[model samples]
Target: MARQLAVALTGAPGPAHRVTLSEVVAQASALAVSGTRTLLGISGAPGAGKSTVVEAILAELGPRAAWVPMDGFHLDNGVLEGLGRRGRKGAWDTFDVEGYVALLQRVRDLPAADAVVYAPALDRSLETAVAAAIPVPAEASLVLTEGNYLLHDAGGWEQVRPLLDQVWFLEVPEQERVRRLLGRRTQDGEALEQARAWVHDVNQVNAGLVLADAHRADLRLRLTTRGDDSAGGSGR
Candidate 1:
C-alpha cells in the first residue's frame, strides 16, 4: 500500500512557504494507525525545526509513538576531543556511525519484552552527550527518529537509509535557520558573539551538507510553520 502523508512548512519566509501544525499531525496519525512497524526518519539542517516537528508529532501521537533522537548517538566530548573534532561536533564524522547503525538495526527487529534500549542525548549547556538519556520501550508501534544524518550517504550513514520505512527531508530557508540556531546557542548559554560566529561558520556549512542530500528522502517537508498543501500523492 502507498504511504499516506502530508508535507507542510511552518515559520515560512513568506505566505508561499507556510506549513501548519495540523498538516503534520494528520500525516503522522495516518502512519500511526496504519498497523505496520512505521519508522519515520525526519531530517533537516541545523535549526530546521526538526526537534520541534518531532516533538509536535510525539505530542499528537502520545503513548502510541516513541521517539529516538539521533543526537543521543553523538560521540562523547572526550572522543571528539581526542580526535580534535570537538569544534565540529555535529558533523556526521563526529558521530559513532557504527553504533547508530547498530541501534537502527536493533530497532528494526522490533523485539518483544526485551530490555529497554538506551539512547544518547546532547546536553546543550555542557556541549556534551549524556549517556542513556532516552529509553525506547519494547511496545512502541511507531519509531520516530530525527537527525541531520538520516539522509547522509557519506561514511556509515548510508547504512541507516534502508532501515527507515519512510524518510522525510526538511527544507528551511538559510537565514531563518541561522537566526534560530544562534538563538538556540544563546539559550544553551553561549555568548551572543560566539553563537553568531558558530552559526555563520560552523552550522551553516553543516546545513549545506545536509541540504545536498535532500533528494534522497522519500518525502520532502518544507519546514515553514504554514504547512505543505500540495496534492501530490505519497511517495512509493
Candidate 2:
C-alpha cells in the first residue's frame, strides 16, 4: 500500500504514479491472506467514496474478504439526544468509539474459533445501528472497515489506528465531494437548499478533521471521476 502526495505538494507529482484498482486488490490480498486475520482500514471524509472503494475491493476478492463499517458504531439517537449532540449526529464524539474498538479486537481474535463473529451495521433509512447484523466468517482472510474517523487522532480514536494492519485514506476533489454529499442528503428527504446547508456547515467541517489525519494512512487513494472513473493510490 502507498500514499500519494501530488508532486506539486511534495515537489513534481510523479507521472509514473498512475495506478489501477487491480494493483490495490493485489496489495490488499497480499496483506491479509498471507497469514493471520488482518484488518484493513479505510478512512475518508464524507463523500470521498469509501464505501464504493471497499465494495470494489470485495468484488475483486470475493469470499476471501469480510466487511465491518465503523458507521455501525454510531451511538443511538436517544443517546445523542441525551448528550445534546443530536443536532450534529455525524461528529466524532457521537460514536461509540470504545465499543467499536472492542468489537474490532474481538473480530480479529475470535473469528478463528467462532463460526462467525457478528458485527453491527448502521441503517441510514432507520437512522440507527442494528446490533449483530453482519457476520465475519472464519474463512475470511481480510476484514475491511471504513469510516470517517479511522485516522482521526483525538478523542480516543488513536486506539483505532493501532488495531488496523493497514489503513487507506480516500481523496476526491472538494467541490465534487460536497456535491455527492448534498445528493445523498437529498435522497434522505432534505430539500436541495437544506442539503447544501448541511454539507457546507456540518459535513465539510468533519471532512477537514478527517483529511488532517490522511497523512497517517498507509495509502492515499485518488478516485478520479473526471475520466473513466478509474481508481489509483500511492504508498506513503
Candidate 3:
C-alpha cells in the first residue's frame, strides 16, 4: 500500500487544526483499562512524514498519551565533534543507546499515578538537547515514541524491540522522500548544491539502512506524496 492508496481506501480522517486529542486519549484509555502501559515504536525512512503522522496522533489522542522521541537522546554536536562524528550527525552511532534504554525502562516501570516525568528533546538548529520538552505524566497510558533508529540493529537498539508493544514503520517512495529532504535542507539555508550533496551522501545512505530495517516492524505503512496505505508482512 502507498500513500495514495491509503488516502483513497482507508478513509482515515484528515489532520485536525491542533493535534488529535481524542484518539490519543482513547488508545491510552484502552491500554490503561487493560492495566498495561503501551510503548509504541514509530520508525520511517527519511522524509517519510513520521513527524507529521505522530503529531496528528498525539493531537487526536491528547493527554492520554505522551511522547519520548529517540531524538532527545542525540549526542550533542560538541560531543559528536569531539568524537569526529559531526559529519554523520544522524547516523545510528550518534545517539546515546544506553540512555535511551534507560528511559524506555522507566516508561515501562513507572507507577501510573505519579506526577510527570520530564523528557529531553532535540534542538535541530543548535543540534543539542533541550531539557524537558516532553512530559510523560503517570496518567499517560500510551507512549508514542518515534525515530529512525527504533528499528535499527546497531549499538544496543536491538534491546528496544522487546520493550515495545507495537511498532509502525512508514515507507515513502524513494524519489519523493529525496525531494522532501532536499527541499528541507534548502529551506534551512544550505546552498542548493550543498543540500543536494547532503541528501545524496548523508540522508540517502542512512535511509537505505532504515528501509532495510522496516520489514522488522509489526506493520508497514506506505506513505506516498499524496497519502498512506498500510500492509502487514513477516520479518525476515
Candidate No. with top lDDT: 2
Instruction: Report the C-alpha lDDT of model 2 over 1-236, residue by residue, as the tens digit.
Output: 23343222244222223345555566676766578888999788888778877777888888889998999999999999999998788989999999999988887786465488889999888999999998888889899999999988889898999999777776776766776887788877899998888888889889889988887876676654335443332110
Q: What lDDT does candidate 3 reach at residue 113?
A: 77
Instruction: Note the residue pairs that clash in candidate 2.
Output: 2-219, 2-234, 2-235, 3-234, 3-235, 3-236, 7-12, 7-13
lDDT of each: 0.73, 0.78, 0.71
Stretches of candidate 2 exceeding 4 Å from the true structure: 1-18, 225-236
lDDT of 3: 0.71
Worst 10 residues of 1 by lDDT: 227-236
User: lDDT tens string, model 3, 1-236?
Assistant: 22332332234322211112233334334554455678888787778767766676677668877898888999988999999988987888988988888888888888867567778898878769898898898887788888888888868989888888776676655666777887788877889999998888888888888988876776555532222332111100
Q: How does each model score on TM-score? A: 0.85, 0.85, 0.81
Which candidate, 1 or 2, would have the higher TM-score against the true structure? 2
Residue 95 accuracy (lDDT) in model 1:
86
Is candidate 2 or 3 superior in TM-score? 2
TM-score computed on alpha carbons, candidate 1: 0.85
